[model samples]
Target: MKNLFTAIFILLLIVSCLSQSTIQYIYNPPENIKDGLDVGTLAEVNIDSSLIIKAVNKIYGGRYKEVHSMLIFKDNKLVFEEYFSGHKYKWDGDNHYGELVTWDRNMPHHIMSATKSISSACIGIAIEKGFIESVHQSIFDYLPEYQHLNSDGKDKITIEHLLTMTSGLEWDEWGAPLSSSNNDLVGLWVHCEDPINCILERPLLDDPGTSYTYSGGNMVVLGEIIRTATKMKIDEFSKKYLFEPLGVDSSTWAQKFDNGVIYAGGGLIITPRDMVKFGVTFLNNGDWNGKQIISEQWVEKCTTEYRNNKGINIPGQASGRHGYSYSWWLKSYPKSGKKIDMFNAGGWGGQEIMIIPELNTVVVFTGGNYLSDVRVFNILEEYILPAIN
Candidate 1:
């Protein structure tokens, strides 16, 4: 009996140690600041002095109450950073809606559609390294298992269409419990014996690349493409190529797939700081600490406006003006009596990486407003933008 008790105690100790080790692996922070700049507390430059106070007041006035995290970087320096109420250090439980409910500053938040932008970055890197032949290559080439898709126009789908949200696949962007196509995809991903085959069975709604349709299915297909091209899982590829180099370590950086295939569309969960690092990498034109993570050509192409759907009514629109790039949103900011070039990687529920190249600025926000007021953009335009200048 004594020997058995000792053995059980040793096994318990081993299990405890393993659990702690896994947690440490997931949430490890950088040993030190990479640039030696505390991005949370950099001084703001007064580009337009008049707009400064007004912008600060607007943000502080509780207009965007659900905005939990905000960070600003200007001229390659950290400017302003803050965390608000409804924010916690980590998500502890799933909400009644079945969404994860962590809000900690150090905890990785659900980036929502911002995952699309990050996934695009992975594709860019793959193309740069010759892992992917070209963006023009048909996605079916990578996932030949999908080549048997019988839906008309499905064979014509290419990487370009998937990246640009122009595959014309019958999918709904909004994950309404009753109406969203994404919910169906999620169900299929969870239950299907062959997930890629299930996704390939989605019907094509229109001619590929001719019309734009926001579809998470498009990104899911891209995830499969990445899997085929690298001959490795997406999570492993991101950790080796993107996250580790950028000094981002997240415990929740995983896909829910059985094979741990990282969802290229929206499965990543990264902290606000890590998300800022991603923005800075892009703001630096894909260079991380003098290493070119992605080519400048790809960055320009990914951020530049590729499609214009006039008067399209989408969420996060200011005056209903919006444009789409390769997994990025293009917005023209009016400053100093001129329209400045700005683009953002935005996610549902107020997650954003707003970049203004002319001003050399980037603003990031992460929030829990999954089904709240859609006024964050107004707060950004009216308050955040003005404060930075």
Candidate 2:
């Protein structure tokens, strides 16, 4: 019994030591770009390095399985950055299970529904540039091509309804996994030659703007609106107006599309570093460096939660419920006994870009923990916030 106990203890010690070396790097992140971001040490930023290290250890120890990369920007400096190995996939049309590959900082991870937030930005830009009329305008005004879909109360649906996911269209994106044919998203992806028109054809189960239903179809319509208004696809429109202004490399960001039409709802591939640039832009009130890429008013309108209680209660979030804005997510965390609101662009399988306006912080994460149930919010609440507290 004594010998068995000793062997067990030794095995545990070995596991612990191995976990400690999971992310073998110093906290002093390198200054990769002179004009892009300034790098600094954790002490320079006044964060408790020990706490951050503990969190990373836990992630590597399988507490947060399959995290690919984490980058934190605070006080105008990139302070802590880390990467880990994990399995992730690329979607190839109807396969559902696309090419599986190991994730790394060099490899761009699919941002999933976070694409909706980017699509939202494109909509805002279009409004400012006169490519789009107004969020209050009937969506059919922009989509004249799909004018036949206007019957059955669908004509009353405004761009605002789609933005808030309150279009009152019957959608089953939340009930089943995307892999199941029963899921509405799968049906939207598979069934039609004209996917946007198919979404419009969905039965209006409730009065427009009266009910909140999570639907990717809403985004598809928005993307098509941009495409219709401008003579370019949504991806091309965003490239010229949004991406280039922010100094994001063209090669680093790509939108997934069917043939030539970008969905703008769930398919975007971006590096974690580039993701932080977006968070900074929104946090800084639509300004990138000096240029106003998006209107300040639009930024406020999009990020602000609608008055009508159309929010979602996240499963593992300690905050309980989160509000939905024009594609952005709104939640508040208790920090040092004060409420700190968070603006976020979140995606399926753990991709996120989180902005703490109060803290002057932006955190970016990319992972493929679709089924793990390990939330970045839990990590933020327990370790990240407390370190700076």
Name the lDDT value of residue 198 in candidate 1. Answer: 63
CA lDDT scores, all candidates in order: 0.69, 0.80
Residue 140 CA error for candidate 1 (Å)? Answer: 1.2
Q: Which candidate wins on TM-score? A: 2
lDDT of 1 by residue, 1-389 (tens): 99999999999999997775444111122223553334433333553434433443444455565677766677756656556556432223332134334345566777877888888988998888889999998777898665668457676878988888888777664445412334665565656666667667777777877787677767777877888999866777778888888877772545566755556777578988788778888888998778888789889987776755333456543435777888888778775688877778887667888888777787888876654554666766676666654
Span of ten consecutive residues with least summed lDDT in model 1? 23-32
Q: What's the lDDT for residue 265 in model 1? A: 75
How many residue pairs clash per model? 6, 0
Q: Can you write out model 2's per-residue Cα lDDT over 150-253, one digit (the tens) per residue?
A: 89988899998998898888788878776766888877657767787778888999999887778888998888888888878877888899888877763233
Question: How well does model 2 score by local distance difference test?
Answer: 0.80
